[model samples]
Target: AKDNRIRFYTIGLGANQMQVDSILGPITVNAPDDLDEKILEKLANESGGMFFRAKSAKDLTRVYEKINQLEPVKIDQTYLQPKTPLYPWLLAAAFVLLLIIRVIQWR
Candidate 1:
């Protein structure tokens, strides 16, 4: 938590900044009551990240969206995706299998 190399994002559900400050400092185990702003702010501050607060469900979603906007994951779709058309081959195989089953049943 004290390391600065890693980045941490914290979301406080109901606790305000002041309340968060009071609860966080240096603790081995955090109680459930202080699990809100205190823990999140501490982790974020120590790791050079941000601490966001959300009081309600809507606010929570908004905070999460903001986090995503801030730090977006990069996906390399060009090389990671297959170039061949697999669906047509799969459909043709399935049709052939079904035709074979039908032929066997007729015999």
Candidate 2:
């Protein structure tokens, strides 16, 4: 981790809970279109972050205001992920299917 300092921000626009699940995990919201509340929750839960939604050009100004109001902070995250052989398996499956098709044609 060079410098060991980074900030991660997740933005969900007109997105349901499932869309944000992999990024933010489980979260409950009343409406998918409401950006204010969703951004608010994300900021609050993610270490005093900033939140805003742009419903229009005027709303864009408000979003900027929210960002300006938040104090500077950093978030550090680390996780373990395992790798599996994917491409080789797919190639093997395709090879088997081609062989089956060739045999069928010969029948």
Can you write out model 2's per-residue Cα lDDT over 11-69, one digit (the tens) per residue? Answer: 33443433225466856654555456765666545653434445445656666665655
How would you encode candidate 1's per-residue C-alpha lDDT over 76-107 as one tens digit per residue?
Answer: 67766658878999999999999999999999
How large an RMSD does model 1 have?
11.9
Worst 10 residues of 2 by lDDT: 1-10
Prediction 1 global C-alpha lDDT: 0.76
lDDT of 2: 0.57
Q: Count of backbone clashes for each model?
A: 0, 0
In terms of lDDT, which candidate is strongest? Answer: 1
Model 2 bad stretches (over 4 Å): 1-44, 72-107
